[model samples]
Target: DAMVIQNPRYQVTQFGKPVTLSCSQTLNHNVMYWYQQKSSQAPKLLFHYYDKDFNNEADTPDNFQSRRPNTSFCFLDIRSPGLGDAAMYLCATSRTRDSIYEQYFGPGTRLTVT
Candidate 1:
């Protein structure tokens, strides 16, 4: 049995190094999203992929990018991580926009910069 999973629930990154966080789901959903949630703040949408459509937030920085090669997987590529980039990265999924349009999130990948 396979399911949506993110390796290393916690990630320690440097101030200006590149890091890649990954996500995979088994629900066979078509829409996958990545969000950055800071302390007591809203989880801001960084980007997402509806099938093959890659949507990025208007204010998202160039340092943040994503890739979804297939339906079951998506990856968040954080290039040149900054101190501000340290936060909880959440991965969510949904089949179609239904009443339960709610997305299922992972344990979150916490990034720490030294």
Candidate 2:
């Protein structure tokens, strides 16, 4: 079965600390998204990697960064995380840009900023 897996399902970091969450997929998808989901709220798109290209949401903070070294792996780096940054970090992948309807999401890494 095709799936996206996020490592370190739960992460805890001190305020102003840096953290990196990793997501790897067995689907070999071309488009990957890094999103943040707060309680009872929809996921907000932070950035995406389409093959080798990176696209960041206009409103996404500069503290958030993403890297996709290849089709199967993606990473999200939060520089100096604050308490407000605590949320579920999700990794989603679609086969193509037009196939947004068919995204496979990872279980997600729940981040906690102390």
Candidate 3:
């Protein structure tokens, strides 16, 4: 089925090391989003790309950066992995930014910091 794809479903990194997680979609959606979710906590929107325009949540930290090299792919770069950063990183896509369009999410990449 055409859907969002995330690689390396699980990742292990040492503290202070940089790690990158990737996402891709076959849905050909115009908007892509990245969310960080901790255990039992609601997912937080890190950033999104509306075509080539990047929209990052104001509260998102500098440690978290994203890149959408093209329409079909996006990458999340964690400048420095921290214990607090260990969580599920999810990638989603929507037809538009409109509320009426539902976002489809990827299975998610679970990060473990040593």
Candidate 4:
């Protein structure tokens, strides 16, 4: 089926080390989004890519970054992994930026920091 897919569903990283999570889609959606979700908390929108344009949430930390080289691929880069940074990172896609459109989410990548 055409849908979003996240790689390395489980990730382990050392403190201060950099880790990257990847997302891809066969859906050919024009909008791609990245989110961080910690235990017992709501998913936080870190950033998104509307085609070639990048839009980041104002409150997003400098440690979080994203890259979308093309429509089919996107990546989340953690500059330095911290113990508190361990959480589920989600990737989502939408056909349009319109509020009425439904967003499709990937399974997510769980990061563990040691």
In candidate 2, how many clashes are counted?
0
Off by over 4 Å in 1: 1-3, 97-100
lDDT of 4 by residue, 15-101 (tens): 999999999999989999999999989999999999989999999989998889889999999999889899999999998645648
Considering every candidate listed, which one attains the maximal lDDT? 3
Best of the two (1, 3) by TM-score: 3
Cα displacement (Å) at residue 82, model 2: 0.4
* lDDT (tens digit, per residue) of candidate 2 on 4-113: 99998999999998999999999878989999999999999999988889999999999999888888999999998999999999999987645355788999999999
Q: Which wins on TM-score, candidate 1 or candidate 2?
A: 2
Model 4 score (lDDT): 0.94
Please provide, for model 1 over 8-112, each residue's C-alpha lDDT reduced to its tens digit, 9 standing for 90 to 100.
699998888889998989888889999999999999999888889999889999999898999988999988998999999999987674655768777789989
TM-score of decoy 2: 0.95
RMSD of each: 1.7, 1.5, 1.6, 1.6
Task: Quantify all predictions' global Cα lDDT against the true fold.
Answer: 0.88, 0.92, 0.95, 0.94
Question: Among all windows of ten consecutive residues in candidate 4, which has the lowest summed lDDT?
Answer: 94-103
Clashing pairs in 2: none
- Supply the global lDDT for candidate 2: 0.92
> Candidates 1 and 2: which is better by lDDT?
2
How far residue 80's Cα lies from its native spot in candidate 1, in Å, is 0.6
Candidate 3: regions farther than 4 A off: 97-100
